[model samples]
Target: MRGNRGAHRGSPDSGSVTDVVVVGGGQAGLAVGYHLRRQGLDFVILDAEAGPGGAWQHMWASLRLFSPADHSSLPGRLMPIQSGHTYPDAAHVVDYLADYEKRYDLPVQHGTRAEAVHRDGDRLLVEADSGAWRAKAVISAAGTWSRPFVPALPGRGVFAGRQLHTVNYRRPADFAGQRVIVVGGGNSGAQIAADLALDGDVDVTWTTQRPPRFLADDIDGRALFDAATARRRALDAGRDDTGGVASLGDIVAVPPVREARDSGRLKASPMFERLDRDGVRWADGTRASADAVIWCTGFRPALTHLAPLGLRGRRGHITTVGTRAADEPRLHLLGYGDWTGPASATLIGVGRPARDAAREIADLLDA
Candidate 1:
């Protein structure tokens, strides 16, 4: 993964009994941090990265928010208005986050990567690379991208060329004048291939196991909203319904990759069966040549250190909508499950739950 600790003030070391310790410094983590600050609670944000912007700063340089600025700003801050009413790029987001941290004088402990969080008697013990902390509670804002999920295809290491995940992607020039096979048709693969094609240097080919069902607008909004509401109601009534969050295809608008495909820029191919010195082999016996393969496959929750928290359901994701483990009350999860209303993993959606979580944490500290 690509990260930058650039231009920081100091190292993150523990010195006090922080009321609550946040385990990440991304948009979600910062949201909870800001709220806890307003509550005048003794807290600190622990980020594995050395700087801000979380994963956004590490995205390909050409990346921009799919949602408009009006739909993506964090709490108490406005996204910078630009001409032409276009979406902001990666750098723009990084700058906005930096400004947010500075404006609020958010007491963030940067460069302190959380190692483990466990209960110690009546308090929580937060261990990090730099130091350890004692807190009354912990906000698990480590995000869905905490761990990059690289699938095990036969002969991955046998391929004799550069291989990179979207998380490691930086700029198009790195692969300039090369034939690239980008795996996965998610937003990242589509956008990255589009940007590379636009750069007029890299020839891009994309692959996906199955084409996602795309929407032009929020056409599927009603059905997806109904599903989320149903799940939320069941949870609120103290029932555990594992299918709270709608699938990605259900919520996100179709990525702009179709435009590239129509223009004959990005060639869509079947999923990879195996990799070799020449290129990728498909299930249909088709072979393609490439110099690099970008795996935009996706990520999983990095809860290795948190295995003791007892996450239920499949993939270790919290099964209950908007509810922490009844057994692990000290573990408050942000961006874990889908909420029926304005509370989802999206930046716009994360606010209400973040507030609710911050208050819950505050109460735990008060006790």
Candidate 2:
């Protein structure tokens, strides 16, 4: 059940133990794997997907990466560009991932879905549907979207419309000529709403419990990094280590809800107070009907596999940096922060942590 999709790692007897095993072969996983190679560390990357594209292939088809092509490339491969282009779409990004894997000769186990990861004494144990893995250390690059956040709204089941999460959203075809209500006011909400509205005939409406804070010219990005760094420093400085969830208020540098607002597509309504046969009711005595609901309500990091490690924050994220030295020492997390530099949670954003973690792993091995 957990074997690779295409290429296998030669014979089963040929497989050797690795210094580290990274779960989820997305941008973060690949980045870490590449760094580990440079560090002369033997490691393996386990990805659930059939290929190297990570979550990009599963995203909406019309989606073009918001970041530039130069920023999208992984550690080893150059993004293939045409005519000195600007931004690349999902397909281009997918191709770049394939090239990245090939160029680096990364030991990746595609189609191997890591079902569980827990501490087996000093070593770490990783279980996939197809096989079991034991490594000296584990890096969770699973990313947050693996577990979609769908709130327990009442009457969700009986609703007479199609309901989907942004992870499954491919294009506007399902929404064509339909009355759609996009839930949540995060970046996904804003982007999808704008796309649907621009396409016409969709009649998209966005709903949020609280007003989202947006930034112009990526001001929110700077603020988020500063806030996260400050918090991390505070923790290091003995300010407080109460295992609290980093507030979305701090890291959220969301794009302006301008398009949704200016185009009459946004609303400050709470989530489903009630779902009736006719439509959905909000907390503020408002009701709306829709043919589809796309929950851009964000995601929860799935650390279920790591549950036996007994490490978590107040909201259940693994609470550690560069191998949880103070708390769950020797456990590290990437793609789980509001970095204080140019990186956000995107592929480009994960490089810093990957580099740091790889260095730390090398040091540990040397020690």
Winner by TM-score: 1
lDDT of 2 at 173: 69
**Which portions of model 2 show Cα errors greater than 4 Å?**
1-16, 76-85, 217-272, 323-327, 339-344
User: lDDT tens digits, residues 1-367, model 2?
Assistant: 1213222243223333567888878788888888887887767888899988888878876566544666556666656674544557778888788778878887788888888776776777777777777767778778777889999988888888888999978776668888787787677876676667767668777667666545544443334444555666677788974332235341122232455456565554555686666578877878888888888888887677777767665777655544443365456676654421224256665676788888887777667
Error of 1 at 215 (Å): 2.4
TM-scores, each model vs. reference: 0.83, 0.82
lDDT of 1 by residue, 1-367 (tens): 1112121223346434656778878877887777877776767788787898887778776666665676567888877764564666677788888888788777677777788777888878877888778777777777767678889999798989999888888888998999998887677777777767767788888778876445444433334445565776777789987464344362244234556555777665678799988788877888888999999888886566566555645657654335344567777777644621234566666677788887766666556
lDDT of each: 0.70, 0.68
Clashes of 2: 3
Work out how many backbone clashes candidate 1 has.
0
